[model samples]
Target: MNLAVTAAAAAGAPLLSGDKGTTSEAAVGETLVSRLGDAMLGLGSRLPDMRPETLGWELSHALTDFHTCQYTSLAVRLPRLLQAGHALTSSSDSPEPALLLAQSYTLATRMLIKLDEQQLGWMAADRARQLATAANDPLAVAEAARNLAVLGRKAHWHDAALSVALDAADDPALRTAGRRGAAQRGLLIQCAAYTAARNGDRDGMRDLTAEAASIADALGGTTLLRDHGGGFGPVTVQLHLISAENSVGDPAAALAAARALSPKALPSQERRSRYYTDVATALAHRGRRDECVRALLTAEQAAPEETHARPAVKSLISGLLVSGRTTSELRGLAARSGLLT
Candidate 1:
C-alpha cells in the first residue's frame, strides 16, 4: 500500500482510450458504477478461494489503482475485488479478513462518492463501518466514519455529517495513534470543515480548517499513510481550503488558495486533479471562462479518467458550452468529456 509509488507511476501513466475490441472508458465507468451499486445491495456473486492474504494483496492493488486515478483499470479490478473481499469475510474467522473487507468496502465507497452514486455510497459506507467495528480496528473504523460523513454531507444531512466527523476525530484510539492518528484526525476535521462551509458556517469552516492545519504543522512535511489519508498534511490542508473557500462562495479566496501551491507538490495525481478541478470551479464561478478551461485542461492532464468522469466536471463543461464565447478548445474538451455527444 505504498501510495507514494502509485503517485509517481501516475505521473507517466497513459490515459485510457477507445480501441478496436476494447472497452471504451465511458463503458468501463458505467459498468463499474452499476456493478458497485449491485454489490452494495449484496446482489453480486462471489469469487471462491479468496484467502486472507490474497484479499490483502488485491486490496493493496485496488487502493493503488484508486490513488493513481486509473479508473478504467479500477473499473475492471473492483468487481473481483469486491466479490473476493465478500467471499473471504464469510469463510475466515480472523479479524484481519474483516478489516481487509472493510477497507475494500471503503474503497468502493470512495469511488461511488466520486461518481456521485450517493444511494450506493451510503450502503458501502455503512458496510465499511460495520466491518471495521466488528474487526475492532479503530483506524479503519475512523476511515469508514469519514466516508459516512462525506456521504451524509452529499445527502444534505449537514448537522449529522459534522457530528460524524467530529466524533470520529475525537475517538480516543485515533487520538493516540501518533502521527498516523493525527493525519486521520486532520482528515476527519477537514471533512467537518467542508460540511460547515456547505451549511453556510463560513467562520466555522475557517476555524475547523485552521485546526486541521495546526495538526498538519505539527506533522511537518511528512505524509503519513498516503494511501489512507491521501497525504493529509500542510499541502493537503491547503487543497481542502481551496474547496472549502469555494463552497462558502468565496471564489476569490479559493483562487488565491489555489495560487499558493503547485499541484505537482501534492502527493497523488488524484489530489492534483482535485486541485485543478476546484480551481476550475472557482474560476467558473468568477466568470473567468478562459482560465476555467485552462484549469480543466491541467486537471485532465493530471488524471484524464478522473477529470472526464466526474459529474461536477461535466456540469462545468456543460455550463461553459451554453455561456460566453465558444472556442475550438472548449468544444474539443467538451466532446472528449462526453458532454458534447
Candidate 2:
C-alpha cells in the first residue's frame, strides 16, 4: 500500500506535496485518537445527527480519500465519520448502521497501521470485529477478519495472522458461490500468502498466491472490485504476489512479477505508488543502484509524502547511502525525501 502524512508524520518529517494526492500519516493517527476520545467523553452532542444514507455517502468519500492516500483529508473526515457512525449505530435499530460502523472502524485500523501504530490499531480492528459479529453480516465479518489479520501481521504475529486469515477464509459464512464469495476467498488466501512471506514460508507463499491467481483468472478479468476499499480482484492479487516474493528475499522474482503488471491498471494512486516502491526494493536488493533510485523517484512522484514515511523506503535509502555513490543527484534525492535526517 501507499500513504501520505499528517501534521504528525510517523517518521518525524513534515509532509511534502506530490503531483498526485498525498497527506500526513501522523495527523491521521493523532486526529483519530483525539476525535474518538472526544466522542467517548460525551462530545457527541456537538456533532449533528446524520442519517444512514448521509453517513454512507460520507463513508464512500472517506474511503476514496483512503484509497488515494489522502490522509490530510482523512484526518478531517474520519473523526467525524466515527462520531456519526457511533450516533447512527446507537440511535437506529437497523443493521445497516452497525455494519457501516464496523466498516468505518476497519478503515481506521488500516490508517493507524500505516502510521505504525499497531497497538492502537488493535482497538479499531477489535471494534470492527465486535460490530461485524453483532451485525451478523458475512461480508462485514470477512472484512473485519481481514483487517484483524493485517494488524496481526503488522505486529509480527505471523502464526496468529496466518491462522486467522485461513479461518476467516474457510468460515462457512464465506462458502457461498458467486462473485462476492470468490472475492472474499481470494482475499483471504492473499492475506495468508502475506503471512507466509513474513514467516519465511516461501513455498506456502507461492502456493497461496497461486491459488489466489487461479481465483482471479476464474473471475474472467471482471475485476471483482473497482477500488482498494474492497481490497480484492485481480490487480490486488498481483500486488500481493509481488509483495510476498519480495518479503521472501526473492528480489529477482519480485521484479519479474512487478514487470508483469501495469501500474496504470491499478485503481488507486496509493497502490500504484506501492508498485513502484516494491520495484524499488527489488532493484535495491540486486545492487541495481541507478534503477533503484529511478524507481524510488517514480514512487515519490506518485506519492511523495508516502514514499518518505515508509519504513522499507527509508531502509533502502540508508542502504543506498551506505554503499556510497555520493553523487549530487543522489544527495539531492535523499535530502528531499528526508532520508538524510
Q: For residues 1-341, write the lDDT of model 2, one tens digit per residue.
A: 11211212233323322223344442334444555555434564457889999998988988988777766676667777888888889998888898888888888777777766676678888888899888887777787788789888887899999899989989887787457777887888899999999889999998999898898888766344322354576788888888888889898999889988889988777888889988887887787888888888898888765665555566666667767576666666666655553
Lowest lDDT sum, 10 consecutive residues, model 2, at: 1-10
Q: For residues 198-232, write the lDDT of model 1, one tens digit per residue.
A: 99999999999999999999888756673374758
In terms of lDDT, the poorest run of 10 residues in model 1 is 1-10
- Give the Cα lDDT of each candidate: 0.80, 0.74
Instruction: Give candidate 1's error at residue 275 in angstroms.
Output: 0.6
Which stretches in model 2 have alpha-carbon errors above 4 Å? Answer: 1-45, 225-231, 327-333, 339-341
The TM-scores, one per candidate, come to 0.91, 0.85
